[model samples]
Target: MHRSAETSLEDQAVDIRIQMIQLGWDTLTSVPKSRAGERSVTLDEATTRVLQEWRTRQNKERLAAGPDWNESGLVFTHPDGTGLRPSWVSEEFARIAARAGLPPIRLHDLRHGAASLSLAAGVDVKVVSAELGHSTTAFTQDTYQSVFPRVAREAAEATAGLLSGDAARQA
Candidate 1:
């Protein structure tokens, strides 16, 4: 069985290419003008599963709607096939988080969380920056430095250990 780098399932390879921005209730746009925001992101297994489930539900909804289904080709949308407003997404996130007993946070905080968690999980900052559509690794480092102090210390210690071990071998 062939497994993709992002997903272990042979048939579950997902390629992300676009982000959706809704300008109004009826207006949706793709292809961010900024090149940084146009990059693709690899999803983890849980995320892929969630997306797969959502896709299946969406397909069923589309079948039910029949001719009424709007062919938007968006990753996320309202049940009736309309694009979701940014405000609606933020409000829904807060509602769900609150229901789950999570502390209050803006939807954008999830982006920061993703970056910091990835870095702490040993993903290179360069790769994280690219996935986040940041123009440069330094910008990512500077922005997330405060969020990953422990990670920074651990990295420093690891580097020191490597150097000390090398010196011991030479002696």
Candidate 2:
């Protein structure tokens, strides 16, 4: 549920960079920049390890930048004192996607991806809405119906899953 990198770091320029810290990627709460804004974005164990390493590096950077820190208290930073701008980062995204030969996509797709992935994992739509900071569960259901239709259709498919016999015929 990443926002523009700026939104992720809550800054103006993204200098602190993905390189700056070991982002303690554990947990699913770090849905940074979810509709609610910068917050936990629970990550997996592997991500946690990477973030831990990045954390070490961030401290190193802090020491290196002593006296010149912005002190925004954010996990991500701008290298120089201050934060990043969401717009610049979002534009770079499109250029990068085009260069990679992938379909051009808005950065918001990551938000969509989060909802989709959660649904595929059988998580409840309400949970996803809260995670994304949506105002209501219906918004989550409407937004990710592609991933959530199964829940809606579960009853209809119950008999269909039955193998052969009268059940299959009824389905």
lDDT of 2: 0.59
| Estimated TM-score for each candidate | 0.75, 0.61
| C-alpha lDDT of all candidate models, in order | 0.71, 0.59
Worst ten in a row by lDDT for model 2: 13-22
Candidate 1 residue runs with Cα over 4 Å from true position: 1-30, 147-171
lDDT of 1: 0.71
Best TM-score among the predictions, by candidate number: 1
Give the Å error, residue 82, model 2: 2.4
lDDT of 1 by residue, 139-163 (tens): 9988874546787888788778878
Q: After superposition, how far is residue 129 of candidate 2 from its true place, in Å?
A: 1.4
Residue 134 deviation, candidate 2, in Å?
Answer: 2.0
Output candidate 2 Cα RMSD: 9.9
Q: Who wins the lDDT comparison?
A: 1
